[model samples]
Target: MALAVEERRETVAAGAARDRFRWWGPVGVAVFAGVLRLWDLPYPNAFVFDETYYPKDAWSLLQQGYEAVWPDNANELILGVPQVIPLSQEGAFVAHPPLGKWAIAVGERFWGLHPFGWRIVVAVLGALSVLILARIGRRLFRSTLLGCVAALLLSVDGLQFVMSRVGLLDGVSAFFVLAAFGCLLVDRDRTRELLRAARAEGGRAGDELRLGGRPWRVAAGVLLGAACAVKWNGLQVLAVFTVLTLLWDRAGRRAAGAWRPWRSMLRRDLWPAALSMVGSALVVYVLSWSGWFASDGGYGRHWADGRAGLSPERTPLVDVPLPQVSMSWVPAPLRSLWHYHAQMYDFNTGLSSPHTYQSNPWSWLVQGRPVSMYWEQVPDGQRGCASADGCASQILALGTPFLWWTACFALAYVLYRWFFRRDWRSGAILAGVAGIYLPWFQYQHRTTFSFYMVLLVPFLCLAVTQMLGAMLGPAGCPPRRRRWGAAGAGLIVLAIVGCFAYFHPLYTAEVIPMSEWRDRMWFTSWI
Candidate 1:
């Protein structure tokens, strides 16, 4: 009897330890990630790659309530000690939406229009992404260890690291998508639990059940909308995920032994799900353009005010008064916004200008071509360079090679699990990949870059972590098999970390011997 009590006490202690680790491990990893992204963030002291566009736009939004044109010497003047914001009153045509720039403006409002100012919000978002992914992995895999592993993998990824350090829209958009995904995951669990409870409470299996207002699903919609507000591609994700959730509802009803599960889902769940996710998303997306709509100086804000054909007008081309837009009754601001969207769509789709660093989507998983966000040749005795030959400083937006390559295999494995084993977790991860990554394939002919894969990195990390969890095997497996599997998984993780360390210099604009930089460049295409 005494021994039984002792064993029970031991088991309780072990469970408590796991509970503590479940929280602390992910938090610890997030803190580590935050440090990696935030350390010396202001170094290089210049706009890196697309930073030339987004940060400037952000500053303009803060001052003028719209993106305004800047002078030719804006970069030089902005970098000076006494910074000058040379913003023109005239609005500029921007392809993407304003939410991302607004996020950067938040940082700039606090720190001024400097590197640290523009980059801080994204860096913080990036770190929060790590924590979010960790929690998400934990929920998906039912293992805190795997969750922390996933967070660690993302934290060390070169592309994620570089994108986080730079002021860019993709990383910001990715954060919203990830958060929305997490919200859906929570909704899935909550829905299942509610179904099970109803069944237990003497409710018939075929009874039409009404789950209360699913706040999580509503939150997911708003987040996905925010993602769209950052970039238009987020609309694709919102569409796919909306379908995914409805399908999940069907599956949940079927699992609860409901007759005609699909019919029931349509009858009971369809419209509510649509309203919570799609309706909320549309609201958030439009609201994100408040600055543009509110400001008279915004590009195209007055587009419909004096346009002859927009309103019924006697035109030379037509005998009767004819309106160019059939929906002439629409409000002017919304009509102008729609016209602006049409132009944005055309510009984004038609862009095929040649860029030296442009890469194909097919080559993204292999790190075939990395964008050089910043590059400079530092002469000896300058910028702390100690080499006899000139040192090179660069921030190459590349994924850690071994990690990415492993993710390729993991992705295949996940597809198999989703197809053959019918794993919901695998399907969810693949849904994210499809939403973010597959859309780019349609734009293949248009100029695309591998760094755009930043949006897909979180899903890839989740896949890799899931595979590692499988390698660790199920708990009931033979001890020897578990040991060997754990060893193999551990080695792969170590290799990923080692590769991250090896390429750390490239992710940060660290000055190193040109030979060393060249050595890290595994492919000529990477240059």
Candidate 2:
């Protein structure tokens, strides 16, 4: 009896050790990634790419509570040239929503409008995303090592690294989408556990399982809302995840031995899930426009007020008549807001302008065309380049080649597992990829860039890590086989890391000899 008790104690101790490792391992990887993202963040010292629009708009939002137009030389003024352009009170007509600019403003709020000031929040978001991915991987795969591998892969990915370093909306949107997905995963597990407990308590089959107060699902709703507020693309994720959550509820009921699992899930779970996920998300999305609502000078804030003079036929797409019903009780701002949304929708759909760096959605997975966010040719003796040939400094939004190529194969493997093996984890990962990727196909004729693929990279890494777990084989495999599998996976990961290093100069604006820059380009499309 003593021997048996001692063995049990040893097992408990071993489990405790594993739990501790799981908690700390991801934290360590996050710290490493954070250092890389945060180090020398102000190096470029200029507005890179769309930073010209976003950072300035962020400053306007901070100062005026709405995005205001600036003087003609606003870019030069903000970039610290001699010009003294002031932001006008008139609202700036921006294509995207205000939440992402608001997020950027948070950083500029603390620090002045320098490079680091506008970009700090994105960098922080990027680093935190690594931690979130690691934790999500742990929960999805039930292995801390795989979790760390996912985190490591994200930390070294060039596109992720560049998006994090720059002030961009997509990185912020990616973070919230990832966080929402993670929360839904937690909700799935919690709902299953609760159902299991209810079954053990002698509940009759087909009875309603009142798994009440799903805070995780509510959290997911809020995050998804934040994502939509950042970019409309997040709505795709919201739709896919809502269906996924309901399906999971059905699966949970079936596992709990409910006599009519689908019916019980629909009757018991549908409304509550909808209210928590869709209803809450709607509330959050509306609230995100508070800045626009609060400011009268905002663009289109008075769009409806002017309709009194216009005829119903004057409206291009939708016929609008003067308000007859005394919506006098209704706020004028809300009426104006409705009209503004129609115009914004038209703008978004009609945008088909060609861009030099625009890439087709089909080639996004293979990194066919990388958008150059910033570039400069330094003289022979400038910016620490002493070479006889002029040096090239650039910030190219590209993914590490080995990692992306490997993920392509892993994604195929995930499709097989999702269809044939009926793996829920594979389904979950693919759902994220589909939500972010498939919608781009609809807009294929419009200008899109590879950097938008930043949203899909986390899911790709997860898929790759899942395949790596499969490569490691079943838990009962021979030690020799496990060793070989580990060696093979490690070699692939190491190769990806090496590729990241080779492309580091391009991701950052590191001035390198022209020959070295050419060597890193690999393809003319990258230039």
Candidate 3:
């Protein structure tokens, strides 16, 4: 009797310990990633790549409440040429939305127009994304260790690391998307738990059940709206995940023994789900444009006035009427806003201007044609270089080759699990990856780059971590086999870390001998 009592106490203690293992693991990894990203962040000391556009635009937004056109020498002034670039009253025609620039503006407002000021917010977002991913992985896989592994992989991914250190919109958009997806995962489990409880309470099959106030799903919609506010590409994720959540609802109802679960879900859940996700997202998206709406000097603010006296034209191809609207009751600014969006839409779809570093979406998964965001040829004596040969300093936006390459296999495995095993988790991951990636295929003829793939990296890391969990074997596997499998997975993760270290110089613009830089390039395309 005493042995039985002791054993019960030990089991209870173990369960309590497991329950207590929260936050610290994910928090620790995030801090580590933050330190790496923040270390010497202001180096190279100039706007790199599209930094020429975004940081400047952010500063304009901060000072003017909207983007303002700058003088021809604005770059020189911002880079400390002893002159202030005065903002012109004319509005600047920017391609992307204002939310991302607003995020960068927060950092610029605090730190001035220096490199650190513009890049800091992105680094912070990137670090928080690590924490969110860790928690999401724990929920999905039901293992804290595997969750940390997922976070670790993402923390070390080269593309994410580089993007974190730059003032860019994609990182911000990616963070919001990841956050929304995590919230949806929480909603999924919460709904299922409610359904299970209902079943236990003697609820009849096919009975309409109302699980009230799905706060997580509502939150997901708001985050997705924020994602869309950053870039239109987020619309794809919003569409895919909205459908995914509805399917999850149907599956949950079925699992709870509902007869005709699909019909029950339609009757009991469809309107609420749509209103929570789509309606909330639409509201947030409109709110995100408040800065533009408040500023009369924003680009295309007078577009409606310009079109007020013009007649609609017939299209040459189809004889369809060209879109024209005259809403006398609506405020002029709102009509102008609608016209502005239409013009922006046309600009986005027609962007085929070639860029030096453009890569097909097909090559993004393989790390082909990584963009060199910053480069400086430092002579032997300059920039702390002691080597006899001249040095190459660069910030290369490339993924850790080992991690990305291995993730391809992991993605294939996820597809197998999604199709054959009907694993919802695998399907969720694939949906994210597909939503971010497949749209790029439609724009193959346009100028796109592999750096855009940063949005897909979090999902890839999740898929890889899922595969690692499988490699650890089931609970029923022999202890020796499980041990060996765990060791192999650990070694693979370590190898990926090692690969990241080897390429660290290129990712961070560290001064290294030309030969060493060439050795790290590994491919002519990378050079």
Best by lDDT: 1
After TM-score superposition, what is the CA distance of residue 225 in candidate 2 from its true location, in Å?
A: 0.2
lDDT of 1 by residue, 1-527 (tens): 99999999999999999889999999999999999999999987999999999999999899988999889988888898665655688999999999999999999999998999999999999999999999999999998999999999999999999999999998999899999999999999999998888777765553388876999999999999999999989999999999999989989888887879989899888899989999999999899899898899999899878552343343323347554656556778887887787678778888999999998889999999999999999999998998888899999999999999999999999999999999999999999999988988888789999988888899999999999999999999999999999999999999999999999999898999988988997888888
> Which pairs, if any, clash in model 1?
none
Candidate 3 achieves a global lDDT of 0.89
160-262 per-residue lDDT for model 3 (tens digits): 9999999999999999999999999999998998889888887653357888899999999999999999999999999999989989988998988888988
Error of 3 at 434 (Å): 1.6
Q: Which residue window of length 10 is worst by lDDT in model 2?
A: 307-316
TM-score of each: 0.94, 0.94, 0.95
Look at candidate 3 and give me any clashing residue pairs: none
Error of 3 at 266 (Å): 2.1
- What C-alpha lDDT do the candidate models reach, one value each? 0.91, 0.89, 0.89
Q: What's the lDDT for residue 241 in model 2?
A: 93
Q: Model 2: which residue pairs collide?
A: none
- Evaluated at residue 293, the lDDT of candidate 2 is 83
Q: What TM-score would candidate 1 get against the native?
A: 0.94
Cα lDDT, model 3, residue 265: 86
